[model samples]
Target: MQRFPFRFAPAYRLPALLFGVTPGTARVEVDDTELRARFGPWSLRTPLTNVASVERTGGFQFLKTAGPAHLSFADHGVTFATNGDDAVCVCFHEPVRVLDPTGRLRHPGATFTVADPPALLAALEDLEER
Candidate 1:
């Protein structure tokens, strides 16, 4: 049994809820958090170790996570891995993107290859608007 500690602000609750995920599901204690999220039908879980925090700016909230690592979004039905240091990966359902630290698009369309936090934040902003 493995336990991962994560902190999600109240703002993100809506997005999680929209995806049919409650706090209980988000804050789960399981053997493999990533695996559980991947196999689960309607849940999106990222390893706490991979995630840093959610950044909010200009009426938008973004889920930010460190990249160069594997990630899964069951609701979005996407699974992919990144390999970059200052890369930030953003997954809004099926659409996933990666950005560099300066907030420039490293990779767009289909798959992402960078992991910059600023880029991730930008994507989050876009999602928040939707």
Candidate 2:
């Protein structure tokens, strides 16, 4: 498994801990067949084939992505954010379960504040080539 860790901003480090999200526990792992993500109490797992696309993004709004996993009211997308800086947005071909406890609600995409967006993107891109 290839693991890509999340980046915790200096300010976000403490706040993220409130949700049990620390540098040690938060990361995204990818393999030949599947992808897995862990953000303390939250997680997102799906087949690598489900990934539709990946793009680098940054400059997150604090209120929208401060701690834990955030759900967008407008887009219904889930965000597992740690910092407001560099990150990658992973879009899925089919919506997947994320925030809804009952597993009724699903998200079209997920954004993560990984330490190295390029590496993450490259990894995802490689999956597409295969």
Candidate 3:
């Protein structure tokens, strides 16, 4: 199996109970061409061979990329991976925070809030342009 050269922490703050130390990185793949186009070039930067699975719950969607790890994000609510494998789920409440097992800040806080997907997408697009 191929390995990624860089490490990745949750770009957004996931609930403490969901995240843990030893965060893993997965190669981003373009399984859905339409979705990739919608997401734009930023999606290309992701490793294309590592995507494991993608799922949606009440208001959130969990993306389980390669490396058998998971990532959580919120759209209308809180969406994240429930297990270490490729299983995503949505929740009604926001996650606690993205911290290691010891509770340390991993990635920076998200600029856009989960409640607003359009704004968040716009902000993400803006960030990509920068």
Candidate 4:
């Protein structure tokens, strides 16, 4: 698997915690057939074909409007972060269950932020084209 890592500044610690996200570090992993996100102690993985759309968004603004899907650190499919830098929002063809630290399905979908918006967006676009 290939991984792209990002560390949030932890500026939104309180808000992140409110959304159940610890807000520190995160990574996006992609392979021939699937894509996954690992945030703090939570993770979400699904088939590459499951992705319906990928778009850039205001890191903090998006988080404010994004709804919380679980109590294990994800809001509106996004993994929380301290700042909105390099944020990429993803939509899936269907809900992909999110697993909290305990490995329980607390939410679904794969919306989150990465360190590099352009790189992540490009990768997703490539996947969609394929």
Best by TM-score: 2
- Best-performing candidate as measured by lDDT: 2
Give one digit per residue, the lDDT tens place, for model 3 in 1-130: 2121122335332532233412232221123221111111111122222222232213223343322223334332211222222222212112223223443423212111123234324333333343
Window of ten residues with lowest summed lDDT in model 2: 60-69
Q: What is the lDDT of residue 97 in candidate 2?
A: 89
Q: In candidate 2, which residue pairs get closer than 3 Å at backbone N, Cα or C atoms, i.e. clash?
A: none
Model 3 ranges with Cα > 4 A deviation: 1-97, 101-113
Error of 1 at 65 (Å): 9.2
Judge candidate 3 against the unseen true structure and give its global Cα lDDT, from 0 to 1: 0.25
Clashing pairs in 1: 68-82, 68-83, 87-115, 87-116, 88-115, 88-116
Ranking by lDDT: 2, 4, 1, 3
Task: Select the stronger candidate by lDDT from 1 and 4.
Answer: 4
Q: What's the C-alpha lDDT at position 128 in model 2? A: 88
Residues 1-130, candidate 4: write the lDDT tens digits.
7777754555555555565545344578888898877665556788999888888876366355332433324444544344656567777887666644454443444555556778888888899897
User: Which should have the higher lDDT, number 2 or number 4?
Assistant: 2
Tens-digit per-residue lDDT, 91-125, candidate 2: 99998887887889999999989988899899999
Worst 10 residues of 4 by lDDT: 65-74
